[model samples]
Target chain A: MRRRSFFQVAGATVAASTLVLAGCKDTEVVQPTTTNVLNLGSNDAGVLNYAYLLEQLEAAFYQKVLDTPPADMPKEELALFTELRDHEVIHREYLKELLGANAIPTVEFDFTSLTLTTRAGVLAAARTFEDLGVAAYNGAGKLFTSKAFLVAAGKIASVEARHAAFIHDLAQAPAFTGVVETSGRYTGMATALTPLQVIEAAVKFFPFTVITSGLPTA
Target chain B: MNLFKIIAELEKVDPEVMDRLSHRRSALSALGDFSKKMALAAAPIAVGSAFNKAMGQNTLTDANGILNYALLLERLEYSFYDQALKAATLTGTLTGAARTAIETIRAHELAHVNLLTAALGSNAAPAPANGFDFGSAFATYPGFLTVAQALEDTGVRAYKGQAGNIPRTLNPTVGGAVVNLLTVALQIHSVEARHAAHIRYMRRGATAGAQSTIFPWINNADANGAPAVVYGAGNPVATFPAESNLAQGGISNLATGLGTTYTVEDVSAAFDEGLDNTTVTAIARATATF
Candidate 1:
């Protein structure tokens, strides 16, 4: 659902409180940077805002997929993507709640380059996202200050790993299996990306000055 | 005099007041030689675990504690997987496919235990004489299922708990030892997931819903996963009386929180919270008599 539509619910009030800074008057809507960029403020909440921004982008992308699915998309693939979409939504909302009262402003994304019409394009993007998330967790694990935060990050990272594996499995075509299970097309390559690297790649994909300072400097 | 004799003579001298002349040089060199060998003897077995002390007290959870701890888990799984491989008693006659699948998983578990032990090197405590108390509770199917579920679940949590430490660079000799560790951890998690599913299936049907299931809370009655609890993403782990947690939580309601008096929700939350690999193994070891 669009942010505006999501805002219709009463839970949105509680959820909205988590997004904004304590006692802030201004709800400055930062327009999408280019067609795909988001701007995160500078703080701990900003880091979360950055993640939230990614989730928004991912959720939007998959929603688009569900709306206008691929011709070759089977029922199973369709179901999996649907599940992924719900997961992204849950992740997005979860972060929204976690960042309570300090959540950064909402941002937009640029997906103009991605060919959303085809199954191949969609799956490739999923691969990039999952890999990026894995690396992001690995790289950022050291950055989190709270021990609980690190543990939580770990839980998400494992899920990201599983997601990466799934995307990689789907990418396996023809007479090949995955390297972990068997030799396949994307066998040797990492479906993972480090946090700093993910940030850099994200910068290329989106137009946002992500200010990361308040998050744990573990 | 022979070296042994000279050493015996040297031992007779007062160590507190060594001779300060050139003649004393030989004794000092002898002591140095002995110290060097001492270092060599302990180096391979426990180098990484020891080097954790150099990490400057980030948290007391050091390499030695973690490495040996993981070794214990691998050993447990190794036993289970090995036994299951030969197990003719898998809900009656085992099909060839079932046997192969379980065996493949078994191989992976063995690899995990072996790899962990190797990492411990000489530091690894000697293997337990019999190894693992499967528990009299496991005498019945449900009892065994509960223990198996706990073990597989523990393995899942254990790997996750240590994933953070993987990239911490215990040995600078090889680049990205931590990354390798993370990879192994992920691999282990996947295999354990498969195992949990298998065990769960053997207990209830493969498609058993969360609704119809009846569970016994023999362990983790007080808490489902850990002391700290977080609902979903971006939330910090809630603190307990002792150590502050740092888990990056996502699933709000995975299992009900594992405490003495748990409801379905509590177990689900606990499952959701997940026990870190180190903590799970520690818990298992603490609970397991073996």
Candidate 2:
């Protein structure tokens, strides 16, 4: 009897949201708004739809970086950036397919603020993108419906964090070259962000409509 | 969001559907309970590692093979997090958040273990219990930060390293289901990266480095008065490793219609400090040297 309640509490998935086929047809879905850059349709699918948006932003940003390598870029840095670029591409493509038939349209972007012409500019751009990427995942991980998806989010967000740290270390490495530092105890200022916050930052690069009415906040 | 409220609301919405989900959850949970119990039951009678030896040498075959390898890595991660969270004397809000996140990660790892075990079935050999050699390295508070950096960073690279194992194409050669899980796996890797960055930001010395550095070439930082320069030490960031130089020939190279001069090794080393798994030990030793 005790176990029954435990089972209900632990097993309760969000109403009928998850079991339904990719729920793009939820006409109740709010369109993208000025405030919300990514219009996740609410619930778990909305959250993934949110992720799909960010992946598209990142993939596009890095795509340009590769397309226009700046002058004086080092063989090493450019190569690393390029490798990172490929990853963003893969992420963008992978996410596009993940939504199945119900995926959001691939919104266009303008990362014009990023100066891909110089080494420092490129690294700085890399830093911002990496930071945003990690934060986007951080905010979204809790919203995931499946244990498999949550575990998978852990695997990828850490890579984004690594990218952020590598850039941090490169620009101002801690005593140890690769060692990442902690400013406060938990690092809330860095890692724990909401989708709203992430989208705010993301819009600086990609000015898309933000519509997240249906996404379950919890 | 409060997990309890979420559960309550979910139960209220559809008791019938919730009941089925509960059954599924219990079934999975039972499997988890049984596997753990069996592991414990066998520990006394059988040599712990004898099971792995019987599974034969690590078979790096299809997606199943790749995930098992990842499960092994995640087990190590889950253990490290469990011990670190237990040992840390985190202060105030940071402590609460860290504890929650540590449990979240631990839970996530366990779920991954369960899911992968289901996928592999009898093929899933309980991985040998490998002891992490952190020893007294992460004992001190500052030392904890440093070690956290290394572990999180390594975790990131390791995921990137393992991604190649999952078939990337989905032509019926890979199927949509494998692709879906792989995408989820990638998402999880990103989430862990965020955790690492959070730790790394906190570990930095308060006074060190330029507090305010402008992001040059960003017109808005100057034009709109958005500080081109990011200011001062941030709140705790994740403590944040790598692999071979296999990604030397990336789309970036293809963008220019020429290959990059950088080798895969160099890029791997950039994020993954200890591909050899020696960086942690080396850093520990180097701490005394400098």
Candidate 3:
């Protein structure tokens, strides 16, 4: 009788736990309709989508600048900006293809905060985006489960860093120190921020909420 | 029944049983029930020791080796910049901006060396025995910039190549610390990229012997008179291709995929490549006298 009772209790426990798990999954699917949320998914997909989103924003910013370049922008600076636009576009398109069906939708960015009319203004905004992209890649590197994806991220991370350095130099020549930790255990290292932190900083640029809850923190 | 006898019998049925038991994550999951039962009877300290034993020791050794390799590289870089800065001949020709940039890079290298040393503790490899002799690199300002660019670019690639090798153990204590090394290496990798860009910028602006054609990013395997190996392929060309190679992630035709209007230089500059440890060490040895 004791053995039979034990089996019955075990069956009940399994059924109850299954229901709880299903309820938790349901809550995730039924988010409130008031705000649009961009879920970055999870695991490798999440990391790629997050990168795709940033590349989209960067590509858009450069494209806008190239469309209506600053009157005072030098010929050489304009050429450099054109290269920047092409690089970002390549990155955006490449990442989109990599994500395929898992890719996030095309995002329309809100660039009202940026001043794109003058050379200084444009370069400053580029610095901001480039620095953020570098930090995002650095932070996302350890989260990748696939070695190929990690290598891919590293390839792009350096390019982003190069872009950041050039923009920083052009915007504040002679004394521009690129985005690096000034004082700490990681003094020489570049800035690396979690997805939550990156999204928090980048939220102002996005029209919709970037839900990074599904992204890896470590 | 003896545990060994059972394990031996199980091995006949499944050859990979021992591998599964030794695998960090698998071992931890396998021990869950056993650990819980032990916790009810044994002390918490004993449980912690059991966890350590389950988490293999080889991971810690591998982590230390990577850290020491990085430490050696940083020390070499720091020494290179330190020697150049101390030389009046090179600094004499450098503009104020150029000098300041070198100073900034040197300070960062020093910080990296110190950070790695602290992380490695006793296992830290001693500084290179004879110190580096940069040879003619410091004889001229442009030469110094050339070598600087190569070293910075190499540093970026070396760190990227080792990223996957850094073990991600399951033991919370060791994993937490070792994983930080991966993060730190990545953070430093990008910083080296930034330094490489700035050095390339300086090279472009040189009044004499200027590599004006060279942009901040690598273009079509152009090493800018630094070694060709700096931009060449590693052991397995497929895994580590030349910087000019447009293929990425199995997509052979990036130009066609993106647009034909995107020139080869644009596509190539869009991404950087990593160098394997063997090639990187050979390059380092060539540059440094030690």
Candidate 4:
């Protein structure tokens, strides 16, 4: 009789737990922008999409610069802007292909906070994006499960670093070199920022919410 | 009471149950359970290895290949700058700014060599003791700059090519160490890139009318007025072709509907290429000094 009572109680508990688990699973299907979060998914998909978003932001910024270049910007500078625009566009499209259905939709950016009609303004903006891009790659490379994708990210990163160095040099010949230095002597190291840190820096440029909740922590 | 005896008895009773699992899957499942139990028991050895990896401990067979290659590159770079600085060649041929830049580059390369050597310890390959011909590499100011540009650019590509291998070979049991190694490699890679741009900028300063033809970025071995001799025989002999490549990951920069007005050269300049092991090894071998 005691064993029968125990069995009945155990069965009831199991049924109740199942219903609770089902309810919890239902809540896990994150709604988009409803509670102000843009789920970036998990693992490599999340990292790639994060990269894609950054590329999109950069591509849009360069496009804007080319669309209405600064008045005092030299023809040489304008040519550079044109090249940068194309590079970012290529990067954005390639990342899009890599992400396929996993990628986030087009993100609307707001660069209105910065003055875009001046060479200094444009270069400063370029500097921010390029440096941030390099750091993003550095911090996130290990999170990828694919070797090919990691190599691809590294290849793109060095190019972005080159862009950052050039733009920084163009703006202020030697000042840009100092930015990469954090300690005594030349470490030959660039900046590296985690996803959360990068998001913090990138948030101001973005008009919409960017949810990085599901992104890999390590 | 032996577990193997019990398993053998169970296998005899239910061969079909054991047969359902492939040998590899069964072993893996056993390992998974063991790890779970180990986790519950708070195994110190596993925790210690995790700590070691996080602290940048010497890798086993897996990641050591990449670390050794990086060590080789750092050694080559360190020797390159060491010779230039010791010879006082730059004082006569280059400006103070250029000299300062080279000094900064040398210091970084030395730091890199030290870091890699320490991380690799006994596993590290012996430093190149002899047999390199940089005489032509440093014969003239232009020659010196050309070689510097090539080495820096090569260093960037070599690191990029091997970066994927580091994480792939990293022991799954000690993931943090892999991240540590990658972080070190990337830090050096970006710095090398900046050095490449800095060298290009200095080279541009020497060009006629400072034409800005090179734009301080890689172009189809643009040579940007660095004489054809600069791409001479002894230099890496083979890996130069990929430096000018305009495509990445089988995707052409000129593919249709890309919607960009940038020319092929512009697109090529925007992306850097990764060099395979043989190519990087050859390049490193070509640069060593006796």
Give candidates' CA RMSD values in order: 20.5, 19.2, 12.9, 14.3
DockQ for candidate 2, please give it. Answer: 0.08
Cα lDDT of model 3 by residue, B1-290, tens digit: 11122222233322223222322333323233232333222222222222223211222237777788888889999999999989977756875777788888999999899888887777878887788888888888888888999999999888876776674322222212433767788899998999998988888774536666878898878898899999998755555677887766434546664434578898889989877777888899999988
Interface RMSD, in order shown = 22.3, 16.5, 14.9, 16.8
Q: What is the lDDT of residue B168 in candidate 1?
A: 37
**What is the alpha-carbon lDDT for the whole of candidate 2?**
0.45
Query: For every model shown, what is its TM-score relative to the native structure?
Result: 0.53, 0.44, 0.79, 0.73
lDDT value, candidate 1, whole model: 0.45
Best by DockQ: 3
Candidate 2 vs candidate 3, lDDT winner = 3
Which stretches in model 1 have alpha-carbon errors above 4 Å?
A1-50, A71-80, A100-105, A108-128, A162-192, A199-218, B1-61, B86-111, B131-150, B160-271, B276-290
Best by TM-score: 3
Q: Please provide, for model 2 over B1-290, each residue's C-alpha lDDT reduced to its tens digit, 9 standing for 90 to 100.
A: 11112222333433222112222323323222322333323221121121112211213547666666666666666666666666654332235434454565555555555555555666676865554444664465555554554555444544544443344332121211332344444544554565555555444334212212211111111211211112111111111111221211111111221222443322232222112112322332332221
Tell me the spans in candidate 2 whose CA falls farther than 4 Å from its real position.
A1-38, A172-190, B1-290
True contacts kept of each: 0.05, 0.10, 0.50, 0.36
Model 4, position A165, has a per-residue lDDT of 81
The local distance difference test score of each candidate is 0.45, 0.45, 0.73, 0.63
Model 1, B1-290: lDDT tens per residue?
Answer: 01111221221221111111101333323323332333333322221121112111123266666667667777776676565444444444334443454465556566666656656667777767877664453343344455665676556556654555554334321121433444444555544544543454344323222312422111122222322221121111221111111111311221211112223322222222344433454566654657
State which candidate has the highest lDDT: 3
